[model samples]
Target: MKRIESIKNPKVKEWRKLHKRKDRDLTGTFFIEGFHLVEEGLKDKEMVNEIIITEEVSIPQHWKLDGINLTFVTTEIMKVISETETPQGIAAVCKQKLAVHPLNWSKTLMIDAIQDPGNLGTLIRTADAAGIDGVLLGDGTVDVYNGKTIRASQGSIFHIPIMKGAIGKWLPSFSERKVPVYGTALEGGEPFNKIKSSKDFALIVGNEGSGVQQDLLKNTAANLYIPIYGEAESLNVAIAAGILLYHLRE
Candidate 1:
């Protein structure tokens, strides 16, 4: 183990670069904070690039590590590299795996220009829970490689495949394949329960404030909404997605 102790170590500079989206792209790797996410990436088996550990840590007996790269750091070094307000003493750098191709997509959810990392992560977790095929990260959506996104996803990020691109342009291809594209809107929408069960459908969730893009929604085969009652306003994008996913799964 190559151990680092100084906060100003050269490796710390490299690690800190991972805090931005550009660096994650340049290095083809992203960092996951805390032990659970590190463990999650380990379980996926194909995505991890390196595991960074500190003196204050515990290793599970089942995390098989035959060929995995492991790096060691002192607590001070770990703190300087950590993304969280309170460092959890562990974080792992993982390669960004290839996005699942559109042809391979089945029942999936498309996120359109959502700006919240926490919302994006929660929706990913919910999609995994509902057995959705994958998530498409459309233009304007926060970086999936963001450390906060990884932490908020828990272990669910690995279980669901994610693709990123311009959804408005890419969705027509799904239309050509005859897959139903559903978009959510505040108006001119059907209830989520109206979604057909045991069929191929892609749900497009929009920005927290903007809702779905007008251009995309105008072309969607179906527009669905979760009803609110008792004088409530609206729901969080993640919660709305979970509700819709629950109905779709049923």
Candidate 2:
């Protein structure tokens, strides 16, 4: 194990930069905080570049960290790299796990312009629970590795392949492949239950305030809407995603 007692250490400075998306992209690595997240990263050894912990934290007995480098820093120093109010005393620097959709994917979730990290995380976790093959984060979607996004995912971030790309470009590929693409809409969409569910299909969920873009929705095989029974005008984007995903799975 290595010790980093100074907050001004050059390596510590670099790790702190990961809080910004540009830095994470440039370095090809991101930080995962908390015991569960770090544990999840450790499951795939190649994904974890280094494990960091405050001097107060002991390595979990179940973790196999033989080849992994461990760094111990003062609690204050850990705070420098942490994004939460109370730091969990553990974190890991993980390489980005690059993944892509296979040619024969069954269920896919396409997220478009979802700005809220929490909402995006919830949708990813929901998609994982519903057995989604993969998730595509569209042009304007929040960063999947954002601290809030990762925490919101509850470790599901490591359980699935999430690729970032423009929905417009991918929609055409799905069309070429004959995969049914469905878009969610605010109005005038076929009631979701009325549509026949399928094991192989792509569902596009839109931004919170603005539903799917008019142009992209045009490319879908059909548009779908959850029938609002009472007076609730709409559902939270994450809730809507869960409802649609499980129904489509059935």
Candidate 3:
């Protein structure tokens, strides 16, 4: 395996750039740190372009790296590229493989302008666990590849299909198919439990502060709200999504 020791190495600079959204977009790849995420990315070997591990770190014996590009770096270089307080001694640069179409989607979670990276990641993880067919990120939402988002997903990012675009563009298609799309809001929404469970549907959760976009809510089959039963005024976007996702899939 090739070894890199200099923090100023040209290749190290390129890897650092992967931390930025624009750079990731330009290169069509993102950086993931920690063994769990690296292993998850390996599940789709074609998408994993390179693997970087510190010289002191050992790969699991069962990991097949036959055709993969493997690189060893010094501990110092690992710290420079790592986003966490405690580096896991391993990281991988993987290509972005976003789902291109909405075909065969029975259940999906549509995120509208959610700005928190942690919230976005947790939502993706929850959707994956709830067996949602896919996730659609709407305009103004945080990048799915953000470091915090990737870590929060606990490697679920690789297990599910995710697409990003204007949420409105997909509404008409769902409308034509008569699939129910539910939006969460504080007003004009029925109790979430009132809606019958279904095998196919879409749920839209919005920005933490503003909730779902008004125009988008108007387009949904129904608007829903998890009733506030206690003194608490609201729920975290991620927690709210988990409750609704499992209920809808019941």
User: How high is the CA lDDT of each candidate model?
Assistant: 0.84, 0.88, 0.93
Q: Where does candidate 3 clash, by residue pair?
A: none
Give the TM-score ranking, best first: 3, 2, 1
Instruction: Return the top candidate by TM-score.
Output: 3
User: Distance (Å) between predicted and true CA of 187, model 2?
Assistant: 2.6
| Candidate 1 lDDT trough over 10 residues, lowest sum | 97-106
lDDT of 3 at 70: 94
* Model 3 bad stretches (over 4 Å): none
Per-prediction TM-score: 0.94, 0.96, 0.98
Candidate 2: residue 248 lDDT (0-100): 88
- Candidate no. 1 TM-score: 0.94
After TM-score superposition, the amount by which residue 215's alpha carbon in candidate 3 deviates from its true location, in angstroms, is 0.6
Model 2 residue 72 lDDT score: 91
Tens digits of lDDT, candidate 2, 214-248: 99998898899998889998899999889898888
Alpha-carbon deviation at 169 in model 3, angstroms: 1.0
